[model samples]
Target: MAQVLEFKLPDLGEGLTEAEIVRWLVQVGDVVAIDQPVVEVETAKAMVEVPCPYGGVVTARFGEEGAELPVGAPLLTVAVGASAADTPGPGEVPARDGRQDPPASVNGNSRPAAADAPGGAAEGSGNVLVGYGTGTAPARRRRVRPAAPATPASSAPPARPSPVPPAPAPTVAAVPGQDASRGEGPVPVISPLVRRLARENGLDLRELHGSGPDGLILRADVEYALRAAAAQGRTAQAQAVVAAAPAVAEPQPAVPASAVAPGGTRVPLKGVRGAVADKLSRSRREIPDATCWVDADATELMRARAAMNASGGPKISLLALLARICTAALARFPELNSTVDTAAREVVRLDHVHLGFAAQTERGLVVPVVRDAHTRDAEGLTAEMARLTEAARTGTLTPAQLTGGTFTLNNYGVFGVDGSTPIINHPEAAMLGVGRIVPKPWVHEGELAVRQVVQLSLTFDHRVCDGGTAGGFLRYVADCVEQPAVLLRSL
Candidate 1:
C-alpha cells in the first residue's frame, strides 16, 4: 500500500501562530525527492519557503493560496514508496479534498509527520513531513497591508515567548473600481461603491484633499467635496442666471449649504480606520513608554553617510547607522535590552538584541525585526536593515521578521516632522524616534551660531530603567549621531 505521510506547519520561529501562504512551489501527483520545498509562506518578518522532507505523491491540501494556516495544523498528505502513478505538468493544482485510495504495498518514501507520533496523513497516502501546522481549523483570510517603512528602534529589552497570536490576514486596500488581482493602476484609493457614487454625481475629486491613509480619497470625503462643489456651482449659476433674468439688477440671495446636501450614510472605524485604531491602542496599552528628545548636529553624519554610499563597496543608510548605535547602547545597558515577562513577576532581559525597524507598508505599520543586531556591525546591519525594509515594502517579509523585536525605531524626519514622541511597540519597553535634521541657531562653544540639528527621542519603560540609565543611553545615542566617527570607534 502507498505509505501515507502528513505534513504539518512549521513553528515559523519567534512564536508565530499562523502565516499567509504567499505561493505554492509544488502541486499534486508529482514525484518529489526528500527536502524539496512545497510552499512559500509569508510570516510577519520575512518570506520563508517550507521544504517537504518526504518524497511521495501529493494527495491533499489543507489550505488554499492566500490562506493563512495556523502553526501545527495539517498542511498536506503524501503517499510515498510507489513510483509516480501520475506526473502532472507544472502549475497544476491538485485536489484539496481527501478522496484518494491507498495503493498496494509500496516503499516507505513518505517522511514522518512528527517524531514519536501517529502515522502520516491519516495513513497510506502521499509522502509528507510532520509538525508543519497546528491541529486547529484553517486561519481566516484577513490581511495586513503593512504601512510605510521606517526605522523602528526600541528602548528596552526582550521577553520570552508570548501567547499564540491570531493570524493577521494580509489586507488589500479598499480600492475604487479596480480589482487588485491584475495589478493595474494603483489600487483605487476609494472603494467601488464610493467610486460609483462619485461618478453618478459628476464629481471632480482631484482638487479635494485625501484624508485617508496613503492619501486615499475616502468615500465620505469624496462625496462631501463633490456635494459642496456641485452646490457652489449651482448657486453661482443661479445667481448669474437670476441676475440676467431681471433687468431690475436685484442682488441674488445666498443659497444655504443644505441645498447641496446629496447626503449619504457612512460606516465609521469598520475598515481601515478600525485597523488603525486597533494598532494604535495595542501600541499604547501594552508598551510602557516615555519619550524624550534632544537636538544634535548631523552635518558630519550626513556627510559620512553620503561618502559611504558614494564609495559603494556596500551601501549603508542613516537608519542603518542609527539601528547599529541603538543595538550597541542596548548591549551596554542590557536592562534596556528586555521584554516584559507578563507571566513572570518581572521583565526579562534579552541576551541578544532583535531590533525592530518600523516599516510603513501600504497596509499598516509592520515592525520587522533584525535578529541579533548586536552581532552585526555597521555594514552588515545596514545591508540587513535595507534588505528587510525593502522586503517589507514589497510584502515579501515573513512572520518571523515581523515579530521578535526588543525595541523599535521610527524615523519621521523623512516626512519633515521636526519632532514627535512616538508610541511604543507593545511588549517592548521603549522606542527611538528620529526627527528632521535642520540648520538652526545654537550656542556652540558659547557662541550663537547655526548648526545642523536633529531631534532624537528615546522613549523607555520606567519600571525597568531609572532616569540615570535612560538618560545615559539617550546621551550615548546622541553622542553616536553627533559624531559618526564615534560609531566606528565603538564598533
Candidate 2:
C-alpha cells in the first residue's frame, strides 16, 4: 500500500509572493531522495533551487516549466511506502481489452488488503519548512491479499491498486506526414504549457515543426517561433516607415524603425528590472533631490596610486582610493550619511556607512553594498568590491548583498561619460558619481599644465541637508582627489 502526498511551493522569504518556474529537475516515475532539489525557480530577488523534503517516487507534477505559480500552490505529488522496483509498478496495472477492471478478492468483499488494517506510519525527514515534514504521512498497517479462486493457470493476479494513469486513445485522423494546418490531426505537444504559450502568443501550432522526440512540440520551439514572428513584424514596419519618408535629390538611408517606429516592442519590467523601476520611480516621486558637481585635479591622486602600486603590497585600484576618500568625507560631513524617515517625519542619522556601489551587468544595474565600509582600508574595499562585482556578473548575488545601503558611489566613468545628474538611490540620502579621468589642461599652482582630472557629481535628498552641507561634502571629496594627503588627516 502507498500513500500519495502533495507538496506545495515553499515560502522563499524576502516578501516574495510568486515565482516563475525556470526548469524542472525531476519527472513523474523518477525516485527522489529527501532534500533533493526538484525545480529551479526565478523570483524577483534571485534564482533559487527548491528542494523536496519527501523521499519517494514522484507520481505527478502539477505545473510546467515557465509557469508562474503562487506561494503554497501544489507543486507535485509523491507516492510513499515501497520503491517502484520492489512493488508492482504503474506499467503492471492489469487491463483487459485495454480497459482496467477492479481487483476481485478471495472472500468476495472486494476490499484492498492494506485498508483492512491500521496504524502504519511512513518515515520522512523531519524538515519543518513549508510543504515539508512527516506530519502528512498515513498511519495504517500493510495487509496482504488472500489466495484467489483458481481459474486458468495464467489467470490475472489479485488487483492491488491502479498505479498507472489512464492513457488517451490515439486519434485516427492525424497520421504521420500529414499537414497540421489542414486540421487533419491533433498537434503533437507533450506539455500543456507549450500549448498555452502558443495559444496566448496567437501562434498557429500546426505551422510549427516539433523538434522533440517523435515530432513532439516543445516550449523552446514555441518561444523561438514567437521571437521570429516579432522580429519579422518589426522589420516590415521599419521598411514601410523608410519608404514613406519624403525623398530629396540626395537622400540618406531612412532611419530604422527602432528609432522612428510609433510603437516598438515592449518588454515587461519584471524581476530585477522591475525592482529597479519601482525603486527609481519611488525615489523620483517622493524625494526632493538636488545635484552638484565639480571638476577635481586628480594628478596627485594618480601619482599616489602609482606610488602605492610601486610599494607592492597589493596593487590598489583607483576606485578603492576614491572609496577611501568617500568614507573620510562622510566622516567630516555626517549629514549626508543618513536617510529621511518619511513615516516618522524625522531625519534618521546613521552612525555607520554601509556603502553601495553601482555595478552594471547583463541582467541590469545592481548596487552591491559593503558593510561597515568606513572601517575598511583600500585593500579591504578592493577585495570586497571585486568579489561583489564578480558575483553580480555571474548573477549569484544574494538579496542581502544587494540591499541595506546608507550611501551610494557610482562610477559611470567606465561608460566613457563625462557627467550625469544622478538620481539618489532611495532611502539613502546621497550618492556620489565619479566621471572619467582624462588629461585636461588646468592651472597647476597658477601655471597651466596638463593634469589628470575627474568630474565628481553629488546628488542628495534636499529634505535631509541644505546646499551648504552638500557643498561641503563635495568640496572635501574634491580636495582629497586633488591631494590624497587630505584623506590622511581623518585617517
Candidate 3:
C-alpha cells in the first residue's frame, strides 16, 4: 500500500501570499522525481516553476489552471511506495476531506481519497521558499465514518418503495435581483481571476449562478454571462435609437465608449501592472513633488563620448555618461540623495547611492537599480546597466534588482519625447529626466551654430528641499552637459 503525502503551496519570496496557477506539468497516476518542477505559478513579482520534493506517484491535484491559491493551501498529494496493484489509473485520484469513497473502478475520476496514511513522515528537498521549511510533517487526522443508522431490533425493517426518486440537486439561483456578493452566504469562487473578471465587468458574483459542481463558479461561466449582458445592452441601445428617430430608415446607433467590442481583449492588472499602479498612486498621494527643467548645449558631452569610444577598450554609452554626471551631481547636492521618513519626521540622507534607471520592456516599465553606483566609474556603470537592461527585457529581474534606490535616472529621450515631468519614485528623494539630444541653433563663441541640445528635468520631493536646492542641482546637470570636463572636477 502507498502512503499518500500532501503538499501545500510553498511561499515565494518578497511577502507574496498568493500565486496564480499558470500551468501544471504532471497529472494523476504519473510518477515524478524529487525536486522536479511540477507546476508554473505567477506571483505579483515573477513567474516561477515550483518543484515537488517527493518522488512518488501523483495521487491528486487540488486546483485547476488559472486558479489563485494562498500559501499553505494543499496543492497536490503523492502516493509513495506504490506497487502495480496499488497504482491508480489515469484521471483517478483519492477522495478529499477524509471521505471513505469506493474504489476507482466504482467511483468517478479525479476523486480525492481519505486524508490519513499509515506510513511515517516523508522526506523532502531542503530547497527553501519564504515561509516553508524542511522539518517533521504535521500529523494527519483520520476521519471516522458514522455508523449506519440502527434498525429496530423488535420489528421487521420497512420495505422499500417500488422505485426511489433521486434527491434533488441543490439550487444556486437566488431570488430575483438579489445580490450574492453582498449577502451573508459565502460565494463559491476559488479563483481570484474569476473574481477580478466579474468585478471589472460590473457583474455581481452572488447574483449569477455557477455551472460547476457544488455551485462552484468557473471562468467560463463569467465570460458567458458577460457576453449575454453585452448583447442585451446593444439591443436596448438600438431600440432606444429607433424610437427616437422620425424616419423609417434607421440611422446607425452611436456606440458608447464603455461598450466592449465583439472580441476585445481584457488583460488583468495583477502582476507587474498592478505593482506599478500601486507605486505610482502612492507617489502622487504622498510626495509633494516639483519639476525644474533647462535646455543645454550637449555638443561637448556628445564629442567627449565619441572621443572616449574612439580611444576605448569597452565602448561607452551616452546613458552611462549621463549616469556618471548624475552621481557627480548627487554628491554635490546630497539633499536630493535622501529619502523622507514620515514616521520619524526626518529627511534621511543616505551615504551610498543605489541608482535606479527606467527601462521599457515588452511587459511594462521597470526600474533596475545599480548598487553603490557612486563608487563605480563610467565603464562599470555601462556594464552593470547593460546586464540589468537585458535582464529586465527577458523578465528575469529579481525583486532585489528592481528595488532599493536613493535616486532614479529616467532617459525618456529614447522614446523621442522632448521632455516630461517625471514622477519621483516614492521613498526616493529625486529623479532626473533626460530628453533627446538633437541638433538645435545655439550661440557658440559669440556666433550662431547648430549644436547638440538636450533638455534636462529634475523632479524632486519639495518636502526634502526648497526650489533653490532643486534649481542648483538642475543647473549643475546642465553645466556638465555643456562641458563634459566639468564632470572631471568631481571625479
Candidate with the greatest lDDT versus the true structure: 3
TM-score of 2: 0.63
Candidate 2 runs further than 4 Å off:
1-7, 26-36, 54-59, 77-263
Which of 1 and 2 is the better model by lDDT? 2
lDDT of 1 by residue, 54-140 (tens): 888765554455544556656666667755554222233333343322211112112222222121222211122222222211112
Global lDDT of model 2: 0.69
Pairs in clash, predicted candidate 3: 94-111, 94-112, 94-113, 95-112, 95-113, 96-112, 180-206
Better structure of 1 and 3 per lDDT: 3
**Candidate 3 TM-score, C-alpha based:** 0.67
* Number of residue pairs clashing in candidate 2, backbone atoms closer than 3 angstroms, sequence gap of 3 or more or interchain: 3
After superposition, the stretches of candidate 3 with alpha carbons farther than 4 Å from their true spots are: 1-7, 23-38, 51-65, 75-90, 94-188, 191-213, 217-266
Residue 279 of model 1 has an lDDT of: 60
The deviation in Å at residue 71 for candidate 2 is 2.5
Score residue 61 of candidate 3 by CA lDDT. 60
TM-score of each: 0.54, 0.63, 0.67
**Candidate 1 stretches greater than 4 Å from native:** 1-4, 29-31, 43-46, 81-283, 307-312, 331-334, 342-344, 347-351, 362-364, 390-402, 439-451, 485-491
